[model samples]
Target chain A: MPVAKILRLPLRLAVHACSGLVEPLRALARHRSLFLLLLRRDLADRTSGTVLGFSWLLVQPALQMLAFWFLLELVLQVRFPGRIGFLDYFLVGMLPWLLISEAVMRSTAVLNDLSSLYSRMAFPIVLLPLLPLVMAGAIFGMVYIVLVGLLAGPLAALYAPLIIAALLLWLLPLAYLLSVVGLFVRDFRQFLPFVLTMFMYLTPFLYMPQMLPEAMQPFMVLNPLADILAVVHHLILGLPVTAGNWIRPWLLWLVLLGPAWVIFYRAQPHMREAL
Target chain B: MSVIALRGVGKTYVHYEHVLDRLREVVTGRRCHREHVALHPLDLAVEAGEVVGVVGLNGAGKSTLLKLLANTLQPSMGRLEVRGRVSALLELGAGFHPEMSGRDNVYLSGAVMGLTREQVDALYDSIVDFAGIADFMGEPVKNYSSGMFVRLAFSVATCVTPDVLIVDEALSVGDGIFARKSFDRIMQFKQAGKTIFFCSHSLYQVEALCDRAVWIHEGRVREDGPASVVVAAYNGFLGTPGGAGAIVPADAGAGAAAVTHADPVAADGAVQPAPGAITARLLKVEVEVDGVVGRRLQLTTHRSNLAVRIRFVSDAASPVPTVAVALTGTDGRMITSAGSLNDQRQLLRDTNGVTEVTLSFPRLALLKGRYAVNIYLLCERGIHCYEEAAQIAEIEVSQEGLEQGVVSLPHEWAGSVES
Candidate 1:
């Protein structure tokens, strides 16, 4: 009986995790075309009035990366002390960082930004948080795959998609959590960009984790984003990585999945009234 | 089977001092907000193929109830069941995106309504033809005029008919031609045996379109019955004198002799407030026909004299109050009304501030129908009413021959038309 009871614990946790993941995916499937239509609308709204319309989706990100490369390589003369080229290393780390920051930043305001689409009507509101994820995934997925194909070979470029899929799954809980928090606590949205900027400086995107002072190196393990980038470099570049790097972020993700979903579910009734 | 059922369904809106208090209350499990009951718990059942109209004053929970049925709002407590594909035309542009082109929006709105791409393709041309904006379908909706915008939205919403349609006063959607078109579409839905829940202030339209009505007052069902009866009761309530803070005392008729110098007292004794300072109210209203003094009378068409004797009291300071008498059908339609002011007559009160006037229609020409008498005490101009006694008497007229409508207009066979 005790052995059976112990076996049921992992079974329960597995079911809990699957439910948290499956419920949203089911809702998305029911509203699959609507999700796509709204995703297109969201993508268009960002570049609607500009003279350079849909092309800006690609040009804007490319221009931003160019500026970062100019400042870090040409002006600051920062070099990576490794066999891997500095530009390849920076591109591999920076593109995924861009995808994460853009999706996370937009998740904070996604509900409020598209509230009119669902507020006064009967609509599936669960699809709203997924919009920013799919949008950022599409744009950065193409850019990352193309760049990786150029630097590391065609076979290695295929890993870019797997990398993006993992990041989206990891971001699922955070997106739902931030969407609810962002609407209820408006001040969180106001200073969120600053927080994202601070997060970027802490993550090893601009500088490798080794370059940080010896004392601060131990603390890098505390940032899940650091764990995420470490795994990505291991998978793509064959860099050395520990099992903790693999286990830490997924462990945190598992911890947050159920709570984030529960909070969002409880807050559904208040969403319309909050606006 | 009941298509819509609500058991103890209610909504109470909780207002927090700050938005954060909502969070605090949720986190702490303590009361931190005040509540306003938008709707009280009540049970209602709407059967299939019944057209029910909702009538109420502003902010009387009509919209809340409709939202509950439309699934836009969750009730605070109770079970609400609406069975069928319920389509709500609450706001025409609810799911419309301003940046999307009209063509794209049609598909988008179809998706929002749970239609597939194939379904939207089938309805696309019809929607475009109905909106009459085919040339501009490629333009972004933000560039469309308000009329064009609403017309397109209306076309999209009604293109596919649902089993039950809930309309919140969107009948008059655009310009005159388009309004007629939209009204025709709703009429078609009604003719197709679709159950409809309509809320509107247009009483005439409600009486014409709905078979039953529900009157919501202060978050409760005040009256619910046949459309004409509920509308008549609501009309009488609207015409009640004290609704607008008139100065007539509640017992004005009981103590008429002792009530003297009953003027609205001015702030300063030296200055007399000239306008509406005098208090006026009805003292007695008597309906007499064929030498019988009673509330309900039987009369012969064009042979009975309908006489109404009105006695009222007015202070000496202001103008004498006008007296008006109206005969109406039992459905609250005014057949005819006669006022002393319209005839340019001046009235005088006795020394005790009481005035009596009698209006007699000798040989009344009213045809065979049940009619009601309503008396009003009006201002000198006959515009503002000081007091009213609605449905004071009932007159049932019998005729020798068949004559339709409420009145018998004077006629004599037209003196042999060329045949």
Candidate 2:
């Protein structure tokens, strides 16, 4: 079969893409018990034999937040334009940032890591990529609860759903696309953590967007994470917000996700052989 | 109704010389990879409740066929309609988690096989019991033996009662006792009227368990028929000395239309018979029963007489030659051989340069299978062969009696049973 034949059937491709998107959701819903059990196992596997089992999830990110806080606030002497404290301002955006970062970075090797599932047993490949997301989500939810309790007022809780939606909208497509592409290019995994670190510095999560020179503000639009963090910062901290800031990230999201969806669906059939 | 129907089903894989070739093929609008056809287009329909065994040599596309049916690999071409759920035991411990306990693995594997948690829970105890490792269910499966692993894996796979069960050499593992138990479980499934497609190198198992058999040779179905007939033909093909290099005449056993071709001389020139010198050569060999001449000699009644006739021509100046014949199984193992010199029998020298000899068996006691005959003309001392024809003829023995092994030995029961 020619590649042109697959491209010609846009209707069929749309149907396949829709089904591909829904399959993981349906699998997770139908096998929620198994999903939860796997999630528990994943947590245990990651934390077992450590001195601090469950607390390690909080400790690692907390330490990283402290280190970044010291570097940005004390060393670099960066300041925000609002009345919100630096910890409060940073935690609000950092919570979702940590979630999306963990989901994408860990998911790059998710398929290769669970390759035994594909070769040894009859497993739904759609659910493989979702495992990391779900695992990260559980930890993220836990951390978010603690952060909201300690650092912010109850009003900040109202924006949790929107922040989560924004995070998933951005992370899911990238995770799916990268996981599929990662199977063919193993070096992508080796280069992933470096790239994610680079992405973090590029996004304005550590520093305020206003602190960036005016000339660099337009480039912030190019980083979807920057737009997402900006929305999260404004909604949770009551900072100033503009319609262009909130809406442009979503428009960029649409632009990024459309090709991811098509590429993921096209690559799915070939995944068995590639793996 | 057919539970599985495949029309012109085929699978082809594109082999790329380099990784960039694949990218180029996808990016550019040109084919840059070599196409390797794993399976040729063929039609097959398997009805519900039929146990069809696939017999083939390695790399003969048996696994590919099973994978296509199992829905693990997409067929490159053709239409395939598989009714009902398919559960394939393609390999043992395929979905097993090494760190998880066997019990947890069962639930996880069951869910992966499309069963809900509740369904797996309901069958959990039975699955553990069937695996016969209830004591170790709490231990991680990685600690289990290979047999135990296969047992747990097979138990979970079959516990769901899939509509179609495709097994590929999964049962060939483990101890003999466990193998028997697995076969019994499969037989129960067969009795329950589930369609089964089994592939194995053990032709005996295929013959014993399958209702029908499909012999795949070189990616094509060489023969498909009743299990006994197809297996017999395959056995005959394998028994030929040169493997597949020997061409089987189309009308091999179709009666008087005999086909003849010169046999290739032996590789050792010193051992090769003199070229163009027909001192003593066997012309035709046939099996006869009750004065009837044919290629196939059917043994309906036990202890029936069978006669093998050989026609030859020789010059008077040639040394008096001895005749020898051997019967070999389909696997090319020699069952028995007889020689005139070995039997201390004398041949009546004929001056006409033509002769016919017949070796008769008073009681033909072979079991059900195709057997091949090897004919040889030896010098007077029976030490050197003037000419020899290997697999000269094939005889098929069909018996209604259920017997195992290559031959049926005549015996009498004298002891009484205590029961």
Best by DockQ: 1
What stretches of model 1 exceed 4 Å from their correct place?
A1-14, B27-29, B241-419
The TM-score between candidate 2 and the true structure equals 0.72
Estimate, for each residue in B1-419, the C-alpha lDDT of model 2 and write its tens digit. 99999999998887888878877987997999898888999999999999999987678899999998988787888999899988888977787877778988898887777778788889999999988899999998889998899989888888877789999964434543354456557767778999999987656457767899999987899899999998778767665663442233434333222222254422221232223355566555666776766555566436567787766665566556788888766555456778887899877655565566889876677777767777777656564345566665577777777888777777766669554
Residue pairs whose backbone atoms clash in candidate 1: none
> How is the predicted docking of candidate 2 categorized under the CAPRI scheme?
acceptable
lDDT of each: 0.82, 0.74
TM-score of chain A of 2: 0.84
For each prediction in turn, the share of the native Cα contacts (below 8 Å between chains A and B) that it retains comes to 0.71, 0.40
Highest lDDT: which candidate? 1
Q: Residue B219's C-alpha lDDT in candidate 2?
A: 88
Evaluated on CA atoms against the true complex, candidate 1 attains a DockQ of 0.57
Indicate the worst ten consecutive residues by lDDT in candidate 1 chain B.
B252-261
Candidate 1 structure quality by residue, lDDT tens digits, B269-323: 2332223333666666778997897667899999999999888777676678788
Model 1 per-residue lDDT tens digits across residues A145-175? 9888987889989999999989998999899
Q: How accurate is candidate 2 locally (lDDT)?
A: 0.74
Superposed Cα deviation of residue B14, candidate 2 (Å): 1.8
Give, for candidate 2 chain A, the lowest lDDT window spanning 10 residues: A250-259
